[model samples]
Structures are given as C-alpha cells and as structure tokens.
Target: EPEVTQTPSHQVTQMGQEVILRCVPISNHLYFYWYRQILGQKVEFLVSFYNNEISEKSEIFDDQFSVERPDGSNFTLKIRSTKLEDSAMYFCASSRDRVDSGNTIYFGEGSWLTVV
Candidate 1:
C-alpha cells in the first residue's frame, strides 16, 4: 500500500530559525493535511489543501507558517520563525475524499520538530 512519508523523522533547531518539514503524500490521493501534536496534546489540524489551494485552515496556522506542493508527490510546510512552542510532532495526512466522514486519513510516522 502507498503511505505518506516524512523526512528527518526528528529535527532540532534554534528558536528563531526557519524550518521546512517535508512530506510525500500518497500518489493517488487528492486531499492533503497537516496536523501537529504538542507532546501529549491531542492532534490539532493546521491546514488542508486540495486542487493546489488551501481548502481550510485552523487558527494554529498563523502567519509564520505556509505550505506548498513543490512537486507531484512532495508537500512541504515551512515555518519562517520557530518558537519553543513550535516543538511538536507534525504529521502529514492524505485521504481519497475531501470530506472527513467519507474516508480515512492516513498519517505518516510524523516529523518530530524540536526548537530550543
């Protein structure tokens, strides 16, 4: 089965530096999403994209963050300035359906971002 994949399973960065977390979503899926779990907290949605534009975004997706599909398979999230609070497990998910209830979203193992 095709699965989402993320790079640098773990990363450590300075508090103010920029970081780009990479993901390669499933080949045939159309809906893509980014979610983050702050240590023990529940997974929180950041943004969802389809048809090359953002479909929905949560408040957590603030000005410092942006996402792009740099190629047919690769999706990326860039944080312009990292904060301590930014440290979390960022998960990339993809689904066949745009609606959540219609299909199951598959998640990557997650890229653990650590800012100090």
Candidate 2:
C-alpha cells in the first residue's frame, strides 16, 4: 500500500535556529497536512494544504511556521525559529479526498524534533 514518507527520522536543533521537516505523501492523495505531538501532549494539527494552497491552519501555525508543496510530489514544514517548546514528533498525513469526504488519512512514520 502507498504510504506517507518523511525524511531525517529525527532532528536535534538549537533554540533560535531554523528547521525544515520533509514529507512525501501517497501519490494519489489529494490532501496533505502537518501535525505534531509534544511528548505528553495531544496531537495538534498545524496546517492542511490542498490544490497548492493552505486549506486550514491552527493557531499554532504562527509567524514562525510555514508549509509548502515546493514540488508537486513533496510537502514540507519549515520553522523559522526553533524554541524549546517546539520539540515534538511532527507527523505528515494525506488522504485521497477532502477531509470532509470521509476519506481515510494515511500518516508518515514521524519526524522527531528535539530543540535544546
């Protein structure tokens, strides 16, 4: 089965530094999203992208964060500046249809980000 794929399984960065997490969702999927889970916190939705634009974004996606589909095949999340609170496991997901269409979303293994 096709699945979402992420790069740099894990990353360690210093506070104030920039970081970019990469993800490649299922080829046939039409919606892409970025979510993160702090060690003991709930999984939080950051942003959702479709048709080359963001469909939705959570409050967490502030001035320091951005998402983009630089190429037709890969989606990415960039943190302009890392903070200790930014440390978490970021997950990328995709679905064959719109989120409101009841399509099952497939997630990537995860990219663990550790900021110190």
Candidate 3:
C-alpha cells in the first residue's frame, strides 16, 4: 500500500524564523491538503490544493503561510515567520476523491514544528 511521507520529521526554530514542510502523497491520488493539530486541540484544516491552485483555505493560512505542489509530486508548506502559536503538528493528507465525497483521506505521520 502507498502512503504519504514527510521530510524533517521534527523541526524546531526560534520565533520569527522560516520553515518549510514537505510531503509526498500516494502516487496515484489527487486532492492534497494540509492540516494542523495544536496540542490537545481538534485538528484544523489549513489549506487545500488542487489542479495547481488553492481550492480552500482556513483563516490560519494567512500571508505568513503558503503552499505549493512543486513538480506535481511533492507538496510543500512554507511558513514565512514562525510564531509561538505556530507550534503544532502539521499533517499532509491526500484523497482519491474530492473533500465532500465519501473518500478516505490518508495522513502522514506529521511534521512536528516547535517555535521557541
């Protein structure tokens, strides 16, 4: 079976630093997304990417945050200036179907980001 894989399993940086989280989804699937999980809180959707543009995005995905599907295989999220509140576990996900459809979304182990 195929699964999503993320690089730099754990990342720590000072406040105001830049961070980039990378992911590779299942080879044959489409509809990619990024979700954030703050400690002890419900998972929150950050941004959704499809057909090379943003399909949906939450408030948390502000100017400080950006996403890209470079080379059509790897998806990346870049945080321009880290903040203390930015500390969380970021998950990379994908599905064969659209968000409203009854399709299974696969999640990566997560790229943990901590800001000090």
Candidate 4:
C-alpha cells in the first residue's frame, strides 16, 4: 500500500520557537491532512487541504499553525510559535479521494515534537 512520509522523526524545541514539519504524501493522493496526538490523548484533526485551499480546520488549528503544498510532492506544516501544550506527534495523512467518496486516509509514522 502507498503511504505518507514525514521527516525529522523526533525533534526537541524551545517554547515560543518556530518549527516546520515536512511530509510527502502518496504521489496520486489528492487530499492532504495534518493530525496530532497529544501524549496518551486521542488523535485530533488540525487541518485539511485540497486543490491548494484549506477545506476545513479545527479549533486547534489557530493562527499559530499553517500548512503548505510547496510543490507537487511536498506538504508541510508550520508552527509559527510553539507552546508547551503544542508538544505532540504530528501525523501527515493523505487520501486518494474524498472521505465521503469511500477513500481511506493513509497516515505517516509521525513527527514527534517536544517543546521545552
């Protein structure tokens, strides 16, 4: 099966600093998403992008968070100002089609971010 890939499997950063986590979704997938799991907590959706625009976002994805598709293959998530509560495992996901259309979302191993 195809998969999404994320970089910097683990990173430690100071609070208030900025961080960018990178991802490469499956080559043919059209929808991209960013999800994060706080230690021992449920996975939460941050944002979703399709056709170069944000399709939806959760309250957790405030002004501090951003996503970008810089090229055909790369999708990235940027945290403008990291906070202690922002520490989590960020998972990049992709779907070949819309969820309502019966497509399954594939997730990457995840990039672990630890804020100090």
lDDT of each: 0.94, 0.94, 0.94, 0.96
Off by over 4 Å in 4: none
lDDT of 4 by residue, 1-116 (tens): 77789998999999999999999999999999999999999999999999998999999999999999999999999998899999999999999998765788999999999999
Give the least accurate 10-residue stretch of model 1, judged by summed lDDT.
95-104
The TM-score values for the models, in the order shown, are: 0.96, 0.96, 0.96, 0.97
TM-score of 1: 0.96
List model 1 lDDT by residue over 1-116, tens digit each.
88999997999999999999999999999999999999999999999999998999999999999999988999999998899999999999999887557688999999999999
Query: What residue pairs clash in candidate 2, if any at all?
Result: none
The residue-by-residue lDDT of candidate 3 on 12-89, one tens digit each, is 999999999999998887899999999999999999988889999999999999999889789999999899999999
Looking at model 4, residue 84 earns an lDDT score of 97
From the highest lDDT down, the ranking of the candidates is 4, 1, 2, 3
- For candidate 2, what is the lDDT? 0.94
TM-score leader: 4
Q: Between the candidate structures 3 and 4, which one is better when assessed by lDDT? A: 4
Candidate 4 accuracy as lDDT? 0.96
TM-score of candidate 3 versus the correct structure, residues matched by position: 0.96
RMSD (CA, Å), candidate 2 to true, equals 1.0
- Candidate 1 residue spans exceeding 4 A from truth: none
